[model samples]
Target: MYSFSTRSSFIATPHESMAELWSAISAALPVTEAEFPLDFSEKVEPSVVDVLKRCRQQLYTRSGRWRQNAQIILDLSWEKLNTGTWRDVDKEWRCLYSYGCLFKVAALCCDDASPATVQEAIRTCDLGLLMGAAIMDNILQTIVRILQNEIGKRHSNEEDPSDGVSAKKMKVDCVSVPVVKQALAVPRIHCPSLESFKKDYLDPQKSVILEGIIDHWPAFKNHPWSIEYLQTVAGCRTVPVEVGSRYTDEEWSQTLLTVNEFIDRYIVVKDASSLGYLAQHQLFDQVPELKDDICIPDYCCLGEGDEDDITINAWFGPGGTVSPLHQDPQQNFLAQVVGRKYIRLYSPEDTEKLYPHQLQLLHNTSQVEVESPDVVRFPEFVKAPYLECVLQPGEVLFIPVKHWHYVRSLELSFSVSFWWS
Candidate 1:
């Protein structure tokens, strides 16, 4: 449940409604608690099981609306999560908090299904998914599906927008940033045999721009990944978006928004308060229809791992959004489906010169901003040899494992990255 969402119909099937979903989720509490071996925090005052039962009892016997008890439960759980150093909280306590949100969802379900109701339900489900342990996957997914179904119904009969047919495609362009200066251009190869690519590039771990490879992707031809197309297909789906110019900024934060909201704020008008990126997400899993537009690069077989081992993430955002100089553990094929990005790379051989962060979490990232390094602060960074390029549509950049890279979009951008050992 934590890792995969099967098309599997469960033995204990869950129905889709606030009330029905609450019952289904409440019923699964015992089984979920049983599945986990009391691994984290073996002792607790009001155990997760105790909390769930008490909350449920309160719901059953409430003199007033369920909100009285439910709201109290929600407030306490919400406070518990906020009061502590979040990572130190017991996993079981997180699960208990999710039950509190479930009661609230059930209470909301007892009311009419208005836009506000649906939005509140979505917020509860998203919060539970983010903070709770994987104990209640089916319950959360059921609520999400129901909310999505409601959203879909609202737009089911609406025709495409008036300007839908002539929606603008992202421009394929380049910018001359300082980081890309005084660097060798990445070598380009046109559809070399997999054997040649591996022997010449992969084994030596060289960065290369691969061409004539992804041109055949349905997203570019038969089913263009136009703003209009994506809005039509995935607008209703809720997704986590990074709200800032870059992830490394102090102001950088995340929130949940539907695809339509993202497009409207960041894509269509470019008028958002800050940059919004639907970055590094497994979008294919959530909106499977979008998955059919592109195929995995065959070169991934060189990882010598099964296809299932690959990690695919979607990077969709407006121009000027930056990925500060960082290194990924696995080899990556960064495929540009729409728009363009100015990319700069450094060898792991120059790791010391790059001045990596001292913190464990940011150790993989360079302290120097590749775009505009402070020569005085990180003097050695100027000595690092690097390669740079402006990746175009239908092009893929083969990034060897641990090669430090920095990327910034030149226009509205959508790229898919496939990582493998």
Candidate 2:
């Protein structure tokens, strides 16, 4: 059994800067002295201590041999730490200290270590600490600081302009030419009355681009909607940003960050591996003040839903973002508030040719790349008929329910999509 006093000389006071953080963490842990056994007849394990000591000795060594040896030691130490439980204070403290030391070494070797190794090291340390490890407060504070600094360094490196290649200039392939059938443009009219829209397009389940309708909206005339204005209004608000050139790629991931950080890191400065997109988000719900800027079109009343039942979503991002071919359950009115977007639509009858994904998560999305599809792999895609159009600022495009559509930004854009039953 292990034994140690709260007043033992092994524990030291944490620095002033991290005292509050250390206190908060300590308060949350089951760290009472009464929980530990008092007897010290049995000796603590020596294997974890020896492995951690070796890891520290070679922490700065960047060679392949050192990495292989350190990884082996880390794996062994993690397995031991994960499987053990402690009733004695002294043994638990030693175990926690060893795991923290191992974490520090892994962080130091991060540049040369695999992502899996780094993740495992952090996970093991977190588990040990949470399992009533009585590590010194000062030591725990030090480990936390080191981890924070390493994360800061990684973010800075990603934003560095000298990084070789970036996703900012990547060209998106929008399929312009017809492969199987000749493509036609969607009909466009200026300021059509509600009666005309209901009789011609809505009743027939056809799509038409309506112009001169949204010019009266405050979003069109008053709000500049520039990068600066967006940052000023919604900068501090938390939002989910799509972090890749396209969602179809395996590397694509989503992250939650402030609108300001999204603009600073992704919009103002670009990232080589991924681009940030605020797409299909209910911005109005989070930032209700923005709702005053745009009004729902009169045509939305023709549907079964009331004004309050309409779902309003915002799509804001840089130029290269693409929405893969997909269908929605309700009628959609996509209003172009600021930039230009090239849109293509396919009737539900052509679903067989679109080749929707077999995976449940992506069932609504097509597997074929609409912009530059592979002829041999998706041969039927060429035979599907589609309507194409470039929607300009202040234009609204009516998309019938279950109509397959794909959209790509032609420039820095902000658009609002309204969905109603």
Query: Highest lDDT among the candidates is held by which one?
Result: 1
Model 1: lowest-lDDT 10 consecutive positions: 4-13
**What TM-score number comes out for model 2?**
0.58
The TM-score obtained by model 1 is 0.74
Tell me the number of clashing residue pairs for each predicted model: 0, 1
| C-alpha lDDT of residue 332 in model 1 | 97
lDDT value, residue 64 of candidate 2 = 38
Model 2, 1-421: lDDT tens digits are 2332323221123454233323332332224334322222234346644544444444323223444554554455455455645433345444544444444544433442333343333334433343324344333334433433443345456755553224244334232433323348888898888899999999988998999888998786687566656754555455668887678878789876667677767666455344678874456654545677888988998999899899998988777778899999999999999888888999999999999999988988999999899999999999998898888899999999999999988767899999998
What tens digits encode model 1's per-residue C-alpha lDDT throughout 71-123?
A: 66566667777876988777666765666667777567544466677767777
Per-candidate TM vs. native? Answer: 0.74, 0.58
lDDT of 2: 0.65
Candidate 1, residue 55: the lDDT equals 50
